[model samples]
Target: MDLKEQYEKLLRYCYMLTKDVNLAEDIVQETYLRFWQSHTYKDTNKELAYLYTIARNLCMDEFRKPKLDDIEDYCELSGESEYEPEARIDSLVIEEALEQIPKDLRELIVLRFTNEMSVTDIAKIVGISRFAVHRRLKEGLMLLRRNIGGEAND
Candidate 1:
């Protein structure tokens, strides 16, 4: 695929990480820049996936830094809207629920649903077996359903 298509995918992946469009764009640009500077990304077929791995690592690094009190201000400056009342409530509920899950399982959900990456691709990216990916996905979905106020059967 071309750079444009790869970029679109990167943008979506970054947005899933930060939930801020401008931050996502910045992360995508940084990912592309890193990819361009690296020797491993010359092949167009693997470039998209390579860029995603870079973007994901960057996001994880950012999350590791200490948070500031003005983080919300930064997010707003980046054009992220304040959540509506219901959405805010739902977000809080979800956040709380996600926190209850182990980091590994949460990462799997982020890779699978947020990025829309395939199970095989996720297995490759995460360096886990396909069976492990499937198990984590199933467990994560169950946790999400319970946390989001839905019945476990759903």
Candidate 2:
């Protein structure tokens, strides 16, 4: 697949991790730079994985730096009035619930649901077994349900 296809997804992933749109853009830029600079794109099939791995690493590095409270928050919610009120409310609730879960779980859930990655791909990126990814995803869903005050795994 084309690397551009993964661009927005990687940016969104980094933004969620860093909570700063400008920093997310910078991180994604570094991701692309490193990918190009390292010649890792020679194998086209693994390019997406490589790009994601690079982005994930950069996001982790972002966590190591001194944080500034002046950074602006990047909320993904759309302000379009065309969206149904109930749907908007539900989205807000789910987003808030997602924020409450552990970062690892939230990332897994986002990788699966938002990025549409398979368990194997997630395992490769996370350096974990498929079983662990499944377990974390299941546990994340349970926690999200509880946070939203719904039945478990509902």
Candidate 3:
């Protein structure tokens, strides 16, 4: 894989971490910088996974800072109404519900759905077992569904 492919994969992973396009781009850029400096591109196949790990760590570090209010303000200023009103409302509700989830579960949902990573890959990235990834994905989805006022059959 070339740099462009690496970047695209990294961008998707970063977007999963941040859920904001601009922030995702920024994280991808930072991932490239660290990757280049670390000289971890000898094997192109590993590049995507390596970049994801870097981006994930960076996003976790960012989350560690006490900036919940800042994130809320940013989300508000982005204007939820700019999109279709009904969809926007639903999105806001879902996002708010996601915020209530613990970071571990939320990360699982983002990795599974937003990044479209396989359970094996997510387990490798997160240093967990494949079974654990599946459990987390199932539980996270159920939590999200419940929080968003959707019925959970199981």
Please name the candidate that would achieve the greatest lDDT relative to the true structure. 2
Cα lDDT tens digits, model 3, 1-154, are 5678657767766655666667777888987788789775675455455667778888888778786577778667544433422347666776678777888999888777865777877887798999999998899988887877742232
How many pairs of residues in model 2 come into backbone collision?
0
Clashes of each: 0, 0, 0
lDDT, candidate 1, 1-154, per-residue tens: 6677767866866665676776678888887778778645556455445667788888887778886669777666656354322347655766667757777788788778755778887887777899999998999989877776652335
lDDT of each: 0.72, 0.78, 0.73
Clash count (model 1, backbone only): 0
**Residue pairs in clash, model 2:** none
Per-candidate RMSD vs. true structure?
5.2, 5.5, 5.0
Model 2's alpha-carbon lDDT is 0.78
**Model 1 misplacement above 4 A:** 39-42, 70-106, 146-154
Candidate 2 regions exceeding 4 Å error are 1-4, 40-45, 68-90, 150-154
In order of appearance, the predictions have TM-scores of 0.64, 0.76, 0.64
Q: At residue 77, give the lDDT of candidate 2.
A: 29
Better of 2 and 3 by lDDT: 2
Top-TM-score candidate index:
2
Q: Which ten residues in a row have the lowest lDDT in candidate 3?
A: 78-87
